[model samples]
Target: MSTFEGHVYLDHHYPPVLWNIVRGGFDSVGLLPDGEKDFAISVSLASMLQNSSASRLEAELSLEQVRLATTPNSVSRLRGVFVFDDIESISRIWDSNKWGGHFIDEYLADVGVWAKKSTRVDAAWIDDIINNQGKLLPGWEAAAVKYWSGRPKSKDAPIWEVLVEGRFCIWSMHSKEAALKEISAIWPNSLGLLTHSMNCFGLGSLDGQCFAGITGNEAGISIDHYLRMIDSKEAEFIEQLARLPAESPKFFAGKPDLEKMCLPDLTGYSGRICAKDDTNLTALLNLLSQLKNETGS
Candidate 1:
């Protein structure tokens, strides 16, 4: 067995920089650029950075687990593999139901408000119709119809076969911008300044709303496996796909196989994008903080 020793963020947000690196595709061929691979993300999901002390505690425990399982020589060779590797921050109480309803409703309202403000539409009409309407009251299609018609005409305006798709796509474009802005506010020097594509493509809805997933790279290979792959020229990345066990519905909740690539939940061990420097990690952390403060989560 191989031993791994290195620093990893026990709690860190998967920011947009890594998102742009991995390919993403959508139902509409044009939604994502050519030759992109789709990765599913959880729309109702929210990421928050653990407190420094809490993060340190988890890191220490994880390191101890690595030390106990592998040999010293193996550990030495594998140290570099953990550097800047994406770490899985396990949630002690992983309950999606708690935030699912509120996040979906608030997200829709926020998107409606953004459309009205950005398009220079009648602010009162938007506020009166889209923003104020409860999730079930006016309904998503009703709101989308009002918002789409209310806004000024443009060739850029999107047309969707299903009204829900329109709500999802339109919200995804704008919400991603909002998310990037939030990240930029926290980390001014972030490399992922530009928004790229939507994650969680094929997955339909999340908690009665569209599943606009988070963007990040996948830990397809575990740290130990990554070390082995790097050491062996024969280890083809394609062959590694066979190592993944069959469908794990408990974690994925009926999401397709592609979602496994998008979210690193299946990879037993954790890693990080920046081990030595955590500036980029703070961008998502700060965004989570602001969100929790506002939402009371």
Candidate 2:
């Protein structure tokens, strides 16, 4: 097994300057061209940084069992990644090199690198945070104070490590961004859905409400009641799907008419199913479903 634990090296090549700028200093992606690949981040995800640039990398950071990008999409241009690579800080808690994003960070924050909140608090680690206050984010003074004080600290501590290690606590994700671009390139109106675990190209309502997303301790979501252990942004995505079924049963609970949903005969598809990826199949299904819903196809 490789000695490096949390690092993920990509196949792309670039000059070594990428890592030099961000190493122990900057967090901006100055080297890469400023494109959609550089921005569009959510506070909900863990960040990524390049440790070296001879090759490329993005990482999946998690302190809990809920997987994030367990197997990231292939890379070229990437985005929303954090820039910091002090590997020793996360070496103890990082799991799976299957690399990249937020679900991982959320898990880490809630559960922790050593274990969940409060259970694994090492008296020594608390002292480290107290003594190394310079490494901490001044904005989180209350949180650090709580850790040292015999008072209740914030439930999230991953930010503490990230801020200390990178001088900034945010996530950068390339594979998921690329995947979203790929999906939106074809269907501009569709809302992208990413799960905390058991991730896939899940379906969402036409209005951008997701049928699934991260819900800590579980991935499946329902409007009636669901766990919020995963995402800090859950309120924004409450499933209207469940509530609609009760008020507008015809649209929500009723089955679609197969006759009205039949696809128009089109030219044969030209793609193959890879042993590793079946998203092509999923996309094809989506395309056919979309065609069936067209008014005059």
lDDT by residue (tens digit), candidate 1, 1-297 = 112221111111233322221212112111222222122211211121111233432332333233224321121110111111111111211222332222232232111110100111211222323222121224433443443343422333222110111112232344445544554454344222121122122122111111222233443211110010121133452232223224322122222233222221212222333342344333433332332232101
220: Cα error in model 1, Å: 4.6
Q: Which residue pairs come into collision in candidate 1?
A: 40-200, 41-200, 85-272, 86-271, 87-271, 87-272
- Model 1: lDDT equals 0.24
Worst 10-residue lDDT window for candidate 2 reads 109-118
| TM agreement with the true structure for every prediction | 0.20, 0.19
Alpha carbon deviation, residue 37, candidate 1 (Å): 3.0
Q: Model 1 — TM-score against the truth?
A: 0.20
